[model samples]
Target: AQSVSQHNHHVILSEAASLELGCNYSYGGTVNLFWYVQYPGQHLQLLLKYFSGDPLVKGIKGFEAEFIKSKFSFNLRKPSVQWSDTAEYFCAVNPRLSGGYNKLIFGAGTRLAVHP
Candidate 1:
């Protein structure tokens, strides 16, 4: 079955450190990729998305992801993470069907802790 997989369950980092979070999906069709971040006590917010055009996508707060269709991967990255960046990150994918109304499949999520 098609699904989304997040490799990291937890990630700890210090301020100013670089961060990389791995995400992979199991689908062969064209997909709409997305990354969402949920703060400590906040609702989930979109971090980035890729539907067409360039594969490298940039999101809020210096976050970016590259979609590698060949490997079915869309890894998120941050050159320098801050304490405020601590949150739960989720990777999701929605394969565009012929008709409409696609469903988003989400990964388990990765909890990130950034220390000051």
Candidate 2:
């Protein structure tokens, strides 16, 4: 079994401030990690994913994440955040299972509030 964790329950940032959201997961074998965002009243959406290829991947809205397999971490970063960036972010993992089905484990989301 695997679990996901997000260190911050809430974060506040001023416009143009840099942001980093910590995330960690416990899993083994080939795995896919992801970040998802949900605005106040919007559906959950994918921010970024790390299935393979480059460990550093870029995502929408100037978000990026680095996959560190050894540490089991996939922290999200945004160099400069804006007021519109306020949202709840969730980290999830899909560890490849020997069985045919794959399960997605999600972390308790971090709510980010960016002030103007």
Candidate 3:
């Protein structure tokens, strides 16, 4: 079955530090990729997405990712992150569904602890 996976279960960093979270998916056909972030006590919001066109895509909050078709990877990266950037990052994928609302499958979860 097609699914998305986040390699990092937990990450710790200091303010103004760089951030990189690994993400991967298992799918052989066309698919839509997305990165959703959930701040403390907040709901999930879209960070970035890759549907078609260029392999590299940028998202809000200074976050970006590259879609490498060969590796089946879409890793999130940030040059320098602030304390506010600390949140639970989730990697998701939208696969073609035969029925239903074509829900999103999220990664297990990644808790990012950023210290000031």
Candidate that scores best on lDDT? 1
lDDT of 1: 0.96
Quick one: how many clashes does candidate 2 have?
0
Those runs of model 1 whose alpha carbons end farther than 4 Å from true positions after fitting are none
Q: lDDT per residue, candidate 1, 30-108, as tens digits? A: 9999999999999999999999999999999999999999999999999999999999999999989877666899999
lDDT of 3 by residue, 1-116 (tens): 77788999999999889999999999887778899999999999999999899988999989999999899899999999889988999999887556645578788878898899
lDDT of 1 at 8: 96
> Which 10-residue window in model 1 sums to the lowest lDDT?
95-104
- Model 2 TM-score is 0.96
What's each prediction's TM-score?
0.97, 0.96, 0.92
- The lDDT-based order of candidates, best leading, equals 1, 2, 3
Ranking according to TM-score, highest score first: 1, 2, 3
Worst 10 residues of 3 by lDDT: 94-103
Q: After superposition, how far is residue 73 of candidate 3 from its true place, in Å?
A: 0.5
Error of 3 at 78 (Å): 0.3
Better TM-score candidate (1, 2): 1
